[model samples]
Target: MTAPLTDDEVGKTVVDAEGKELGIVAKVNGSRAYVDPNPSLTEQFMASLGWEGDDEEDYIVTEDMLESVGEEIVLRGEI
Candidate 1:
């Protein structure tokens, strides 16, 4: 079986099934990982790719959706 990821590896890039740039793992809250759609995008940009909140907001992604953790994080589906 695959090993589980640790907190240190949580804030990695979350890619899509096709290896597309989806978002970056912001933080792990409980059983969910908050994903920041575009890590480089500033809050004032107001782009649709980002999470539905300000820079201080956290987007909750379930642990089950997490695919892998390495140089980049991978998710099961689009964020």
Candidate 2:
């Protein structure tokens, strides 16, 4: 089991295995979070922080993907 992360330690840079910028942590909703990946990537992004439809609509990223948590937001390798 992993220790719980705090809100203060959230918003950190999420880099890939090769140290590539993915995105910044937006917010944590439930068991997942909203990772706004870099615009350069072709992946779609959420317009805001909330639910939309059948899909979570918030770019639901799991905590396991988290690479590091900072004073601002959480960081994940990829989502």
Candidate 3:
């Protein structure tokens, strides 16, 4: 398993294996990252897309799905 994402991951660009920009990390909680597919939203709205919400619109990326992390977060496979 991959290591958990840190708080710094928030706002980092997220991409797929092919390097397609999927979204931005809206929030980080332990091993999970709440991704905002629509990056144009305000920071306040982005932060609301959390695990505690019942909304299915929010996307989640786990540590195991990560391919690499640097200036951006790349997933092992396309979401």
Candidate 4:
């Protein structure tokens, strides 16, 4: 069954099992979370150099990663 989306789940901090910052919950669409993944070194460098191209690279975190759905989305691990 699909888990219910908590009120605070969206727009909250998502952390790994060991409390590493993965990313933020950009939007919760249906049962999916459109997570904008942490930028790569190249992307960061390009941004630093004033590149404004859109980077449509993001990951979808599903119910499988939710160890808990409160305060923060505590993931099972690095997923």
Candidate 5:
């Protein structure tokens, strides 16, 4: 089974299976990672250890959609 995502994922870049840049991980709650498509420096900094953000534009990526996690986080399919 695949391992769950952690708060360490915050700030990491997220991409689709085709390598299309989707966004950056802003927060991680349990197995879900919140992606901020256009985050400011302050928003990025405030995403410490899974603290939730108030941005309505942010989207959620669940563990089932995760493909891999390395230099960047890659999703199994398009967003």
Candidate 6:
């Protein structure tokens, strides 16, 4: 497994393997990273496109989902 990103990586941009922008690191606590998810044009737009799982839930960027850490956080899988 890959090593987790540090809590200090907050505010860094996060991207998926396909290089799709996920969001920015909001807070990192233990094994989870709270992300200020990428903006959706509107609530309806998010629902219409189904950007991801659940929009209401808080996003946590865990180590398991992480691929690497650099100027920005790189996620493990494709978008």
* TM-score of each candidate structure, all chains considered together: 0.58, 0.45, 0.75, 0.62, 0.81, 0.66
Q: For candidate 1, write residues 1-79 as lDDT tens digits.
A: 1235445544467677689976766655456666677565553233233333325644666767766667876677543
Number of clashing pairs, model 5?
Answer: 0
lDDT of 3 by residue, 1-79 (tens): 5556987777788899998888778778789888877755565354444322213455988998998888889999754
* CA lDDT scores, all candidates in order: 0.58, 0.45, 0.74, 0.62, 0.82, 0.65
Candidate 2: list runs displaced more than 4 Å: 39-58, 67-79
Question: What pairs collide in candidate 5?
Answer: none
lDDT of 3 at 68: 86
Highest lDDT among the candidates is held by which one? 5
Q: Which residue ranges in model 3 land beyond 4 Å of their true spot?
A: 44-56
RMSD of each: 6.6, 6.7, 4.2, 7.3, 2.4, 8.1
Model 2 residue 30 CA deviation (Å) reads 2.9
**Candidate 5 lDDT over residue span 21-67, tens digit each:** 98889888898888999988887677644455747899999998988
Q: Compute the lDDT for candidate 3.
A: 0.74
Best by TM-score, which number? 5
Q: For model 6, where is the 10-residue window of minimal lDDT?
A: 46-55
lDDT for 47 in candidate 6 is: 29
Candidate 2: 10-residue stretch with minimal lDDT: 46-55
Winner on TM-score (2 vs 4)? 4
lDDT of 4 by residue, 1-79 (tens): 3366543354566788998888666556566665546755664454345342333676778876677777677778645
**Using lDDT as the measure, what is the rank order of every candidate, best first?**
5, 3, 6, 4, 1, 2
Q: Which stretches of candidate 1 lie over 4 Å from their true place?
A: 1-5, 41-58, 77-79
**Two-way lDDT contest, 4 vs 6, winner:** 6
Which runs in model 5 stand beyond 4 Å of their true positions? 45-54
